[model samples]
Target: MVEIDPADNTAPPAGGKRFAPLWEPPPAPTRGRPARVNRTQIVDAAVAIADERGLDAVSMRSVARALGVGTMTLYSHVPSRDHLIDAMIDRAYADFALPDPDLPWRTALETYARGYFSLLRSHSWLLTVNTWRMPLAPHVFDADEAAFRILVDTGLTANQVVETIGIVRQAVSGFARAAAAEIADERDQGTDYEAYWSAQTDFWENTFDPARYPTMTRLWTMGAFDDAATPFDLRIGALLDTIELLIERAGGSGTAVPSFDECVRMSGPDPAGCADVDTADA
Candidate 1:
């Protein structure tokens, strides 16, 4: 984990510094004693529990056990369970590669949206975290700043930039949440989707009256549910297309943004393409 100085007085232009330095490392141990642990280790342990068992399993006691320390010792580093959760959320966001600024606004947004969806899917418990209750952490702020920076320079007003990013973020999160639910359902059933749905064929044929539900019968016959990815792919593509239209209506050329490949090359050696772009201006 990166250490930031909590005492630093510098503030970003956006709204007088609403978040504290939650990722800062703990004070070093005194002489003759080994350093017990750091905030990063605690957050990592908590996140591991959440990823393996689920969010509800991530109590301070559980994390302390995982770290081979007493539960009270965790408080000295994280303050509380809520603060530990905030750190976990921030750590997840930090995993994201910041959007390449040189890419066109659309490409950059697409890349970010896909990455966000992937993260949520991988860590399904993340969807359960109440983001509204937690102060913005550095990694979360970095994502927002990168998205805003890309869209802000494209002739959109500040409000428009904010709204646009909100739309994209909501779409990605919503889709990922639904996908996670579907995955959980399958796991609980101990069967794949096709096998489970096939077992319900008798119910559809007998209970679902064909005369009253013509479209339903047609869809069942066509095996529409067999390919879950089609609907998700189509919806995401349509959403991106609509956003492009909105940009054009605002008198901005949708093609003006650079390609993802170009941004990668510009970032040389680092595939994440997160070179020092001014996030504060966003």
Candidate 2:
């Protein structure tokens, strides 16, 4: 559900010009034929399907079914699947509470990231959706705008701000994809990440060569595989530190950002947990 950037919106979208249909009030409509279906309902239906069965399960038809409306009636609200997907993507952002305008760049950005990640986790479909597409919906734009402002406040040029946003967004995307894959596989097995990782640790302990991987061996010895540490914040904090360095390097004023490697490698959960998780490309 990539969107066109409003800032770069140059002309009508790649469709032949079509006239807006004339509007007519229904003659004293009864409760049977509702005059309107709120946009929130459409988005809520989409979100419900995404949360329950993942994004692919979300279709206009499914949404209509969820809404107890005729499929054709859905078109009156969401003109196309693409359009519906657009709304769905933006609607997820609406769940994110944007940063306080008065907060420092770092605190605001961190808050934004937390909220964004929360939404991604809550709406797993977002993990599969493309982020490069420009956002058109007001809520999506508002979030991006909030991020851009933080970057600018950090003293980054507009170009730098844009690039930084792309980088951080990729970090979020990477984590979300990882989460989605983990959840998808777990759902099929009726288990969770911790359980799957525990199984992985048992397998690795049996097969991994201590001679070939000394670091892994030491980590294993340290009970890194056991319920000793949750690495989520450690990794996220490391990424923030890396980004802070990048910011300092660019200039004293701009926000720093992290590469996917910095985010994943530093913030990555224990290797023992993902030991059973397939690393091979699917």
Clashes counted in candidate 1 amount to: 2
Best by TM-score: 1
**Candidate 1 lDDT, 196-269, residue by residue in tens:** 76799789757878889888778877987465462134257777788777777877533333334544666765
The whole-model C-alpha lDDT of candidate 2 against the native structure comes to 0.65
List residue ranges in candidate 2 displaced over 4 A: 1-36, 200-206, 218-234, 252-282
The lDDT of each candidate is 0.70, 0.65
User: Which residue pairs of candidate 2 clash?
Assistant: 3-134, 154-253, 154-254, 155-253, 156-254, 235-267
On the 0 to 100 scale, the lDDT of residue 10 in model 1 is 29
* Residue 191's lDDT in candidate 2: 78
Instruction: Give each prediction's root-mean-square deviation over alpha carbons.
Output: 9.4, 14.3
